[model samples]
Target: MQEILDRAKDCYDSGLPFVVYRKPNETDVFGVFQSNDELRSSKDFTEKGFVFAPFNDDNQVVLLQPDEVWEGKYQTEKSEAIKDINLDESGKEVHIELVKKGIQEIETGRLQKVVLSRKIQVRITKPPFKIFKTLLSKYPNAFAYFIHHPKVGTWCGATPETLVKVKDKKLKTMSLAATLPFIEDETPKWGNKEIEEQQMVSEYIGDKLAHTMERLEIDEAESVRAGNLWHLRSEVRGTMLPNLKVSEVVRALHPTPAVCGIPTDEAQKFIHKNENYKRTFYTGFLGELNLRSQGELSLFVNLRCMELQGDTASIFVGGGITEASDPESEWIETQNKSKTMLGIL
Candidate 1:
């Protein structure tokens, strides 16, 4: 464990590119370290290494080849200690207005739902390892990762949503949405807004995968907890077509209703027009693309993530908006989502 940590820190300190991650509910950690800093893009998604993709398809999808590899077990038996994180509310007014416009778009029959997001910069008092350690212990069910490269800088996350996982001809993915702060010993009473939002995502996923999968099955939505929030989630699984490629499945589901809106293209266009900021890889996907001879794939939707720079960190958070959304309440939802990363910081 000490040797792996030392190598990772050395790679980061020397400005080399690398990615170290642990999949959800997995004990072993795997790392892919680049020998030198160089920008590489995986356009066809055939890259046999770790990939860090962007929210928008227009941008280049960064890839880091596993020139050197490391693997070890990380203790998830207990959580690491965390210091209090100081966060100030920012961009509430702008986000609220954005949510209003999104609701209006839905009311006018333009979109059923649109996901909106914001970023808050908070001072960091510890190194990246400390934060990553806290994340690994805190969220055992999340795809926790720490990635750094000269081109993309540094981005780390504990994402709960799997973009897609392929083992041979078998394929599995998740449609997760709706958010409420988690309580200790009670079942979540999901409202209409939450139920509809989750259903929209599941339907969108099913429709998208209908062509590629030989058979599709979507289970009932269930309540799952991640960090300080509870989300309504459903699993969509099936067997792939005879010649279905992993890249095709990935591109088709890049921006699901969970991250974007019902009519994905239009909602994404509105987000680009009104958000007034680049999301980069915040709501994007990341993780191992192709591994070993069987060609297994595991990539996750980047949520509850932050970009680190100098002494401050940029934490990103967002929520899905529908006609039932209240501007003020949506604003509050974003705040609650932010605590997932903020609390561990």
Candidate 2:
């Protein structure tokens, strides 16, 4: 573990690209160290390296060549923190207004749904690697990763949403949406708006997979807890059609309704015009793409994530907005979502 950290620090100091990650529910951690400072991209999954893509297709997909690899079991420890993050009330009001505008568009039938997001900047006292270690110890069930590239910047996240997973001819994905703070005493009672929001994502994923899957199956929706919040989740599985490439599947499933909205192009346009911030890689998917040795691919939605630069961290959070969405409640939901990263900080 110490060696991996030291190597990562060396790479960062030397301006080399590298990525270290621990897959969901696994104790083993893997690191890929690129030999050069070049930024690489791939459209097909034939490359043998780690891929870091952005939310926007126009942006470059950064890849780190697997020149050096390290694997070790992550040592887990309790994380103690002294600070509490306060919600930005003014920022919340601004996001609420954006949600209201989205709702008005929905009422007029411009789009069925839209995912709105906001960024919160916070001052940090701990080293970025220390916070990343805390995240690894905290969220064992999430795809925890710390990626650094001189050209692309540094990001660390513990994402709970799986964009897609493929092994052999079988493919697996999930529709994850509808967030609320978790309570210990009782079962979560989801409102109609939450239920419908989740349903839209499930239906959209199923429809999209139909294009490349010979047979598709969607499981019943259920409530799953991630950190301090609960979200509605549904698993979708299918057998891949003959000759279906990894890029095609990714193009179809990415920026799902869970992250974007129904009628993807229109919702994306709305977000681009009104969100007033660059999403960069917040909602983008990242992970191994068709690893040659394993013959499998696993990618996750970039949520519960933060970009570390010097002593400041930029945290990103968002939620799906339908016509039945409440602007105030949506604001609260993002605050709850922020706890996933803030707690470890």
Candidate 3:
């Protein structure tokens, strides 16, 4: 860690922005990359960088350069706790209460879609980045990210959600996801509500990208079940502008309505005010800036994340709250999401 930190500092001093991270569950090899003007790929893993899979199901790695590497340490304040938070509020008043609140928001026009999150505290000293790397190498579909700063240590997740993807001036994005626990051989059916929710997301993204790209191609996406929940997902592809920086596109589209909310500013404000937690980097996006190629950035929402504060590990979880969304069901959804990593613990 010290060696990489020192090297990153050197690169920063030399005016080169870089990012460093480790895949979940893998050791000895960490991801590193130096920013370039365009996108490229690497077959040889000599230069430290991230290895990304081409498709969602491809368990391949893509080497990337980061702008910063962060290592986080949790610090607790001196305060007496009131009550013990439940690990999975599958059947509880809290779940119902949250859904009701979301309904109210919908009725009042505060938001069209809002993503809610919760923090889970586990007891352990193992660095989360270490586990993150393991997941990366093991899950071909999983993605890993870690952003280290002096004051903040933020890591990445092995999420299947694609905020956006670009190659050879061809751009693609997805409306992913509304999730429930994955059940085997369930026939992957999409009810009216699920399909409608997914369509909303797809249309929103397509409209958002329409002016920037030409000839958009949208296809019917299927349902993707993760852990204990299922989400509605769709893929939207198009051609990029002749001169559009991958970074520019990323900045324009990150913290999407799927993760944040529609009228994103209002939804984010509500979240900060009502959620009653410092999300730090929970829903933020992090990935490689430049890989074996130039102008390529792979960033994923910081979901399924846990923070190591001393001997305590706090895992974060949340769900999208819509007008049609029930607070109780939303809460249960989060509980189900928590089970994904809690099982590992």
Question: What global local distance difference test value does model 3 have?
Answer: 0.58
Q: lDDT tens string, model 2, 135-245?
A: 898888999999999888899999999998889879999999998888898789999999998998999898888989999999989999887788999999999998888
Counting clashing residue pairs in each candidate, in order, gives 0, 0, 62
State the displacement of the C-alpha of residue 194, model 1, in Å, after optimal TM-score superposition: 0.4
Alpha-carbon RMSD, candidate 1: 1.5
Tell me how far the alpha carbon of residue 279 in candidate 1 is from the true structure, in angstroms, after superposition.
Answer: 0.2
Candidate 3's clash total is 62
Candidate 3 ranges with C-alpha deviation above 4 Å: 1-30, 33-96, 125-130, 154-156
Error of 1 at 319 (Å): 0.5
Candidate-wise lDDT, in order: 0.87, 0.88, 0.58
lDDT tens per residue, model 1, 1-345: 556778889999899999888889988888899997989988777778888999999898898988988999987557765455455666877888888888988998989999998888888987888888888888888999999998788988899999998888798998899999888898889999999999999999999999998899999999999877899989888999988877899988989889989899999998999885899998899978675644688889998899999899999888899989999999988887877888877
Per-residue accuracy of model 3 over 1-345 as CA lDDT, tens digit each: 546645655654454434445433333334353554234344432333443322111222334444433443222223222233346443356546655676688789877777777676768634544454344443444444443332233333556666665667777677786776677777566656566666777777777777778688888877665545677777777888887666556646666878777767777777776774667656665554444356554456666665555567677778777777766667767777877666544
- Give residue 204's error in model 3 in angstroms: 0.9
